[model samples]
Target: MDWQAHARTLAAQIVRPESRWFEPLATTPRHTLVPRWWDSVDGQWALQDGARDPGRWLDVVYSDRTLVTRVGPVHADAAAPGTVVDGLPTSSSTLPGLVVQMFQHAVIDDDTSQVLVTTGSGYGTALACQRLGEQRVTSIDIDPNLVATARERMNLLRLRPDMKVCDVTGKLPGAYDRIVSTVSVRPVPASWLALLRPGGRLFTTIAGTGLIVTADKTEDGGAVGRVTPDPAGFMRTRQADDYDNPTREVWEKAQHADGDSVSVSRYPLLYVPDSWAVMSMLALDVPGIDHRVHEDGDQRTVWMLHPDGSWARATSGGFLEGPTVHQGGPRRLWDALERIRNRLNREGQLPVYGARVTIAPDGETTLSRGGWTVTL
Candidate 1:
């Protein structure tokens, strides 16, 4: 099937030599983990079950991209061949490149520091098992079926990493020298700190935003690290079957609701996902600013909202000039976005990745820079 050739090409394009994950990216057999996967078609994500067409399956399996394994709560394997699941992606094995990037920051060593990684499609677990012996690794996922499938796949490769179905946002299972999460978290869980031995390290992505934090546990029961230069996004941990579906409601409110909530914007059309520095600043200053983007034939819309009754809607009409922005509520959404842009423009700075993180003994994380502090 020329699987090695396909993997080699995809790896070359995504994995850099400077990355610590070069070996895993080059050696792990990604084609085996995702033989068939769903593809986006006509604005909906569809699936091609592995047992179907070997040719089409191999191409998808080796491609350096994400594949949706579950829609809502239904696993792709349970669906018929060529079936389309028009629901939000509830589970996925992240692309090999991004997985490697997360692992690159993990900084696994030859020492016998037990490693813990979140299991989704089991691909990341396989890579960890490959780097450190399977015995030294433990991988967990909230979905029982996913953990079961991942365990089977690891066994297929004759590896034996401990597998469990557990929510990483809550209490972790055991003590570890290193903890790395593929799933994102809103706040660095205090349970995670308790799970780490003194001097242990953690590499993880922030939930609801594109930020990666790598911190080391201190003797005083706290941690500290700076944001990474790269932008990485992962599925936020879900306590329920599905997220509350707030986007539609928010959009409808914006279209219908009106009030005399005057506000002066802080910033411009700063696409949070595109700009790491601004994204970091927003996340640091105002934690939990949810963003979503939808694109049509010629129009693109980016919506920004916060739990604090703040909302901003920006739309690009037909690929023309500046976007039309409508912002309302107690806090001016556009103003905040513009404020961030202005700070970057005037002071030639944005405090995000470079901002210092201080995890207090009480589990409060505060980002501070230039006499400004944001409690997260």
Candidate 2:
């Protein structure tokens, strides 16, 4: 397959014609970085090998979609054929368009400016290297194996950037003029501000939501900015080999028990992750809600479980119908969600995007807009 031609075609579709990133997107070979990945099949992850089906491989690689490269420390390249892992995704090659959008947010105009990016499959790092030389780009990942693999793949294309294995929340290897994270983080890391040069900019998403913050370093060792109008979401940053799996005991209880309260849902069932504004508001107000959905024929069931022993299960026969909800524990999970929905209905939209953001020296982030305020 003519991968360069395919990349050019993809570049034309995704990159703005007048943008400086068009040439970089056109020339980068994404297939080299993502030779194997995982695909979700029936709510489970299935390995997809590019060498096994080159035609399908070329199609998926050139298309605008995220390719899951690792799930619970199982890199797709090392997995056997037909291997299926029932765990959350640990790393991925983010969609090319989103990467370009993030770069655009960073406003990398001068070639002399140094930038630090999160290395996934090294695809985004390759784009950065193409625009600014390898000397100006540094990419890091928490997984040592992923960093090594990405370094090897980039070598195949003769595109080398500084690749390091370092936890994003910890101290960085060097100072940078711009820090752009493709992974989500909670309570903007103070290390980022300390490592960034004065007048440097940082772009990242809030954990569990699509809130994209773009802040420039301030003189007071803090940063002040606003959430971008555009929404972007990414997997949370992990410090260990793998994220902790949900406790089986908590899952069993949330799945079977009818708790302290039972009532009819005031609003239709909502999968909070689907909506940018709704998810951002809910995640900020009541963080760490594990959501799951099940569908059997005409019936659909939605479950919301919290680590704090709060759980809510709602079932409905159709999309428009209200769900019968059962709640247990100290907090009413469904009631909190309903209140947010009600507020959204009243205000027409949640003021998460474009909200003014203030980050203190101690990593406290305050987001405010209109008359609402939330501090993390």
TM-score of each: 0.87, 0.97
Q: How much lDDT does each candidate structure score?
A: 0.75, 0.89
Cα lDDT for residue 279, model 2?
A: 81
Cα miss at 145, model 1 (Å)?
Answer: 0.7
lDDT of 2 by residue, 86-107 (tens): 8989999999999999998888
Model 2 TM: 0.97
Candidate 1 lDDT (Cα, 0 to 1): 0.75
Model 2 misplaced stretches (Cα beyond 4 Å): none
User: Candidate 1: TM-score?
Assistant: 0.87
Residue 175 deviation, candidate 1, in Å? 1.1
| Candidate 1 Cα deviation (angstroms), residue 154 | 1.5
